[model samples]
Target chain A: MVQFLQQIVNGLSLGSIYALIALGYTMVYGIIKLINFAHGDIYMLGAYVGFICTVQLGLGFFPALIIAMVTCAIIGVVIEKIAYKPLRNATRIAALITAIGVSYFLEASTQKIMGTSAHSFPDVLGTQTFNVLGVVISMKQIIIFVVTILLMLLLQYVVQKTKIGRAMRAVSVDADAAQLMGVNVNATISYTFAIGSALAGAAGVLVGIYYNTVSPLMGLVPGIKAFIAAVFGGIGIIPGAMFGGFFIGIVETLVTGYGSSLYKDAVVYIILIIILIVKPAGLLGKNVKEKV
Target chain B: MKKLVIALFVFAMLAGCSSNGGGNPAGDGYKIGLHYELTGEVADYGNAELEGSKLAIKLMNQKLGEDKYESVEYDNTSSTTEAVTISTKLVQDGVIGVVGPATSGASAATYQVLDGAGIPVISPSATANNVTQKNPDDENSEVYNSVFRICFEDSYQGAAMAQFAYDTLNAKRVVIYGDSTTDYAKGLTQAFTDQFHKLGGTVVATEYYVAKDTDFNGTLTKIKDMTYDALYIPGYYNEAGLIAKQARAMGIDCPIIGGDGFDSTTLVDLAGATALNDVYFTTAYTTVGASDALQAFIDAYKAEYNKEPGMFAALAFDATNLLMEACEKAGSNNPADIQKVLVDIEFDGITGSFSFDATHTPIKSVLVVELVDGVQASAVSVSPKM
Candidate 1:
């Protein structure tokens, strides 16, 4: 049905955002074995940074977005150095708690600075609709989908072919071994944060343009949902996060479209619960055998 | 030496006792506490409510003389727990009456504290019907009896919005998007559907989003395929603004109607001028005109704070005045007497006036305002048919 197809397109577009944010969560989890709770808040900061560049500084969309990505990358490195780096050998729980604290501190700071009001983002892509198979899709949605896919491919290529990418995988596998093999373990981890935060920043800009609104706490829900997507897809698995994000987005859309809208979020969480119950490791996560 | 010593001790004791009683006097004067949210996502709403209360207080003080009553204020900062804490502090401070805990959730939290202390608390904007609909025989019913409100319940506002869509806008079918987190949103959606269907309009589809959701494309896409005359979104400004922007971007292109939750400058700022064009919403009052009373309040507010008072300020002003009027009519600061007088008293307000019903819900006119280029242009007053 046209309606069904349209919903899928809509789902994919939203899912792409979730996918981008999920990658950040998955990568951090993959390397650090810690859920960076503040990752979402970093995405929020990215959006605000992009907002300031575009709205206040009068930069074009692309320039502002690039600046936002670079800014977030720097913030990511700083956060890692200041917050996570010091606790590199700390318990996972301690790192997680620190992440949460950082998240709260960032959200509170944004609220204080931004004054708890929603700011309208400048319309970058003109609001024009293109019809495909009796389904009307906006230019913004199309751009978001295309850009997300391109970014995902770029990430895949980077991880598979690049030197730093190998270093990241090596570090993830065995940080001590990688360090012994002359790999800069800390630099690799910082690089992972940089890439993850940049992706989150891009997601922020995309969402801001798509939603046409930005707020201090805008990143919180999407951040949580993206993390769910990462776990659902098998946390630490890059492609898995992509699949999971799209899956969650489509499922949410379908549930709200056909089922009771009130229970849509409930349905999404239920899916996550069911998926987790079925496969403790995740949909695509491998069962690791711990060496004695 | 004994007389001198006794005189000094008595004077010191008398001074201490007077200081304690002087905090709040009896029939000669009264203390009314205002608990409102001054910060957070709904800060604008709280700010408006506070402003209205302030204006009302100024008028009451001017009419009754400042010596007749005293007013104190507390900011709940848009937290339910804070509302409870503030209400406890206010009651401890011996406020004879209290006004506002703005939102329904905050009101629910403060109700227990204020009701336990036998203080009459009235909210100008807390419209959840259940807030005042307590079981008469239940022990908790005491809270409901002491609480009152100036705004009509969502039941009326929802029905009014539905009627406007069906009769005025002549929409044949409507799609409803509701925010499920707040009782205000759910209540309005229910009312809109019940009244719209009752009036022979078909609700093609209904969607929902949470308070924190920024994406509505999935839901909007579903509705885009369906033929609908108008979209009814019953949600607060935060989500509503995003919904409006995304809805427009999706090419749904139907008029959107909402409730007082949409009466925020933030909504326009969030939605943008192009997106918010032709949007209609309902509110308790409007700041468009300079009516004699409104102008005077505005002048006083500007003189005091050097800024134009928003709608919440006007409502708070009226609420304060209403309490003072009740006190004067009762000729006492006793909570029970003032409560009875509040229920029966009807005075002209900036927005207009009606006495409270048994539920403490005011029977007043609702204003339907149209957003013209990001500003409220026209306001029409609608009263319940009953």
Candidate 2:
């Protein structure tokens, strides 16, 4: 039981990172109906930025994290404007292809610059483990959970209570109607990208601390997994992505802890298939009739 | 349209007439082929070889001048097909001998082609048994005539470490985490497992992961309940370092051992000082050394490049000098003569003294290097009897 609880602690720590990245995927999908494949690379960029801030610029962990989030938010807005905005009226497939292109572009360019080698991410969260009820948890794991929950609450408050949030919701409902209501459609879309990218950036810094290593291609697998998390919980739903991230994380950790790790990815995909079979719109998604 | 076609044909002819650097040399200098990875996956090792070999060539040129060597350089970019192109290009350009593609796959690709051409090709560090030994099962099988290497074969390293683990570290039960993608990793894994069992050590479990995987907590957790005295991971430094870090984080205290994959400076940095405790690996040479000859080479390398020479540098230096020595012994730069001379020559190097065994691989002692306080320190030297 202690071992099981310990695995849950590991799962939560891992899941929070996925949750943060999944929020980005879910938000962009919510606003534009486009899956931003480069969202994962944004997380990678955040880690790199944080690395530079702390290592070369000699800033504290929190300062580096904030700097990375701001930098990524700006980058996210620019990427949406450049890559997706022009293709707004085009087919969804085209936008997805561009997102994938952007993802590869970020990976290749970073590999060219950084030389495809791993860098040791500085230890920000001190190396200390605390025992609670026979289960030991690291300091970084605690930070991941607390920060992720706080950010999710803040995100919920922003979307529910703010004017921009209302505009975002209106745009997601009907872009033409939102434009008629004077919502400034382009600005709302850009705001969505900024928020999503900032969340991904924060996740990137936290993951770098937990993993203690960073590489150019570090975002690829995690990005795919986070996307899976987003889809596993209704893709465009806010609460769903968060719940899905934690769920996948816990399931993955438990599977590896008690079962064969070679089948972890296979098991995750199988669960997703079962979930989709039962609820075609995702776990929390409503079945809505649409014009074909 | 006719005039444009004629003009294009003339331009193409003129482009082909241009001379590349290192293809031609004035006076009585020998033209050697510099075949190493300059811009690919293993470019770091290739770059080190280039630096060390270039330094050796420069110093040799200072003494020989006009009889100094000019090299036609080819960067394989760590691909076998690219190695073929470069090997052919080197041969067509008339190099006396070749000094490295820096990896077993690259060497395997080009060595047969170079051997067919009867050119002597020496690899700085390709360790796979088939790299030097074309016929593995036969005791008296003829060695690959034109192919030779300065590093010990793959089997030697794994066997040495296995002996060290049983006799020195006193390990009994082991778990192996092998990289299933590469022949290098697979070969080391097989060799280590065979030797370990031969020495009465039971392998508890074997796990495999592909390269580029950073997450191993899954594997760590799976192995947590299993009983194992040591972890033998046969793979590169990146994943090895990550495994060590994850293993420690999961509260596993068993000593981790591996082959030459854990040699890089990045291993210490990635694993940290505390995580690296009791981590050991076998490699060509110990980085922490103070021998007069080794120190002289190190000092000279540091003076020239403002950095300590990695093992690749030392190996490439030996390869370069070995090529030069063979050329001198043969009294000509002819491929046939150089190949003939190398078959019987013994060269002493900074890594260790070695001559070609029946397999065309150098016979040398493999060092069991251990990580102490995150710094690579020499642990023990194992001489192979098999």
- Pick by lDDT: which candidate is best? 2
Q: For candidate 2, what is the DockQ-based docking class?
A: incorrect
iRMSD, per candidate, in listed order? 13.5, 9.2
Reference-based lDDT, each prediction? 0.82, 0.83
Itemize residue pairs with steric clashes in candidate 2: none
lDDT over C-alpha atoms for residue B305 of model 2: 86
RMSD of 1: 8.8
Best TM-score among the predictions, by candidate number: 1
Stretches > 4 Å off in candidate 1: B1-34, B37-44, B47-79, B93-97, B133-145, B274-278, B288-290, B295-313, B320-347, B372-375
- Expressed as tens digits, the lDDT of each residue in B31-90 for candidate 1 is 888787756556657766766676666666677666556667776768998889888887
lDDT of 1 by residue, A84-188 (tens): 998999899999999998886677556645656677788878878888878888888888998999999999999999999999999999999999999999999
Measured on C-alpha atoms, candidate 1 has an lDDT of: 0.82
Q: Judge candidate 1 at residue B341 and give its lDDT.
A: 78
Candidate 2 C-alpha lDDT tens digits along A1-292: 8778878888888899899999999999998899999999999989998888888998988999899999899889988888899999999999999999988767755654555567889988788989899887888889989999999999999999999999989999899999998899999999999999999999988888888787777888789889889999999999999999999988988877777665677788898889889987778899889989
Cα misplacement distance, residue B179 of candidate 2 (Å): 3.3
TM-score of each: 0.85, 0.83
- Model 1 compared with the native: what TM-score? 0.85
